[model samples]
Target: MANTSGNAYGLTALCPIINGHTNDSNPLYKAAGESHDKEVRRILQALPLNQESPFANTDNTYLARLFILNDVFFQQGNDFKRDQLKSKYLCFNSNFHGELEPYLTSLWNNNENQVREIWQHCVAFESVSNANDFVRYIKSCQLTTTLFFNGSNDQPVAEQLKALYVKQMFSEFVLTQQGKSAAELKQAFKYFLQRVQLNDVKSPSWKPGQTEVAL
Candidate 1:
């Protein structure tokens, strides 16, 4: 089984910058320096898409793992340790990469160009407005794949992806609102939860699991 616990630091660092969440004083922004484009390329290289096309075989586990990793990276403090992060990534690869290979090979065998556009969008997601936009994109891709491939198993897959997205978004939102008083933060978080619940009502598939979003 693939280990889905590892975080995607590359996306976490890049997305906030792209969405204007980070500033010059931020360590992540400083790390990118003047060559932000180069840094993006380097990060993409570090976390490449599956060897095969993303649209063909239809296993979203790898994609989900990427989002999970990105969330972890986003939540890291200014005192982030490169050595520790590297060790975690190594463990993630060892545990999950092998398991994901067979599915990727099947996807590649089925179509070389399938889902290429979505893959490009994912890698070049800096233009995305925020975490919500990013999550919606993933949900859309999962839904599109389901419709195109006529797969019944993908609904749950898409839900899982949305759940992860929400979890990360909430975490990031809370981080940004650090100035809020405890009561204010709590109220804001409750309101956010209500919004998420309403969204889920509109589209049940987007509903996260009970424990997915914590206070």
Candidate 2:
């Protein structure tokens, strides 16, 4: 942490960089700051956030990497893959998209657009600075990940499977928009299905009575 800043002013030395409330020490902030300088900013840019904190810590970069990994991983599996021409990433990118839609909508509806924009600017994660491009990244993914679970009459599994088809279409749309032919979509489908088969392999198969049965 900042080369210990000498024996007398140890922690007091780092007040200019990190929030003293969180770090509270010289060696901690120093070491963290050095690591952050190298990794966090670049990863945040790759995640393509609006702005990167010059002094973000290792924790922030680690999380950004996880997001990128999840993006690629999701593109690989079958059932695990998203359904739609778009994905969870895109739809969620919408300024106000989320599970708490009703509440957000209630606010959005009753308020004037000007007031709504102000509130959005002042409150909520989406409203705040596009920290690390968080909202855009999520919206890009969400365009396709909707469950669309009918919840009407079919069993849960049926509805869930219904979503897979949509996710497949989503991949195709992405592939197409990027200039891949329709045939390439078929290829990606095959690639992901193979991954799904591999994931299936991780679980033991069923036996008449000696197996873990799911309901």
Candidate 3:
């Protein structure tokens, strides 16, 4: 795979072709740790090409973050640290235990497609001008809602849901009270907390915050 050098972006200009072998006694392919790391790095670097930017493409960013998190999880020698990292990063079975290049490529492509779907279905995302707005848009979108509930529990959908809620709250404070000081922001947050009740439905009960806050 490393026979050809990568471009300036650390991505290969041409994907290497692996010929199928008909031999029954051929040894199974095993990826070296170093090779896996290199492939992960390459994929992360190329992720931006799949979209305008990481911030504009949450699904792609999500996949890139997963690769980084999984890499960190693998590098730790301590068992306890590894376990902790695993709990946080390795939520879903991505079927990444096989070949390195193909698996990483598949992940990047799949995320790219998912981001496209999100953009197509979620019109609110187009009007997002800031991080907070982006979060609110994602929270209000049905695509994210479906993914949050029907999607795999092992995935980072739960983390995404939490992030959306937090961003939505922060954005609400900023949008409604434009000239508020830090003290005012804090007070608003406290007031919001007192009035907001997280019921069994997990939905917040404010004007705009009353959207479906799923996990």
Candidate 4:
């Protein structure tokens, strides 16, 4: 738990990690406080990169902010953050609490049943319609490859069906108001390509000669 004094906006400044703060805004009489503040500033200067927030006033606030920070870093496109969140996306059973890295890696590599099961169970994801169509298109490719999924996934299949409906809906239901932007469609296509390139999890449809060519 770190302590924070009021900063410029009086937001209990948590960032730019520091101990005691400054502005020349306040006049102080104690030389000891000044010395302590200088030492704190020195420590902060020395540990810029790895510094923690000094205004995580409560335990819950600290945890909440930490989670947000993790999300920010993840979304910033950092390789480490991408890997970390991808681990969260591809691995990690939210219901079962335990050591995640090994269990998830094992499940991803060795257990398609579990991986598909976990994947199918996700309900909170943004259902990107164009991407979903592209995924189904790839899945429909008759290359000797197959991504085995749980047979019990009727709902998941329905969801895929709905995504198909969504892709078509833009044209049919929306009366040609306009479809997804070209950039959005390209991003969807790129995402599908990336999925097809899973290293240890070779997808059959991904192999050459299995799918149709678009001229």
Please report the candidate that would top TM-score against the real structure: 1
Clashes of 4: 2
lDDT of 3: 0.35
Candidate 1 ranges with C-alpha deviation above 4 Å: 1-156, 198-215
Mind sharing the TM-score for model 1?
A: 0.25
lDDT of 3 at 53: 43
Model 2 per-residue lDDT tens digits across residues 139-204:
333323222222123222223333444355455646655766789867976865654443342222
Q: Rate the local accuracy (lDDT) of all candidates.
A: 0.38, 0.29, 0.35, 0.28
Inter-residue clash pairs, candidate 1: 7-69, 8-69, 8-70
For residues 43-143, write the lDDT of model 1, one tens digit per residue. Answer: 44554344332331343333323321222344457876543222111001111122234444443444434323223323444444443444443333331
The best-first sequence of candidates by TM-score reads: 1, 3, 2, 4
> Model 4 residue 114 lDDT?
31
Least accurate stretch of 10 residues (summed lDDT) in model 1?
87-96
TM-score of predicted model 2? 0.17
> lDDT score, residue 65, model 2?
20
Angstrom error at residue 191, model 1: 2.1
Q: Give the local distance difference test score of model 1.
A: 0.38
Position 69, candidate 4: lDDT: 14
Q: TM-score for all predictions?
A: 0.25, 0.17, 0.21, 0.15
Which residue ranges in model 2 land beyond 4 Å of their true spot? 1-30, 33-71, 74-101, 105-141, 145-147, 152-215
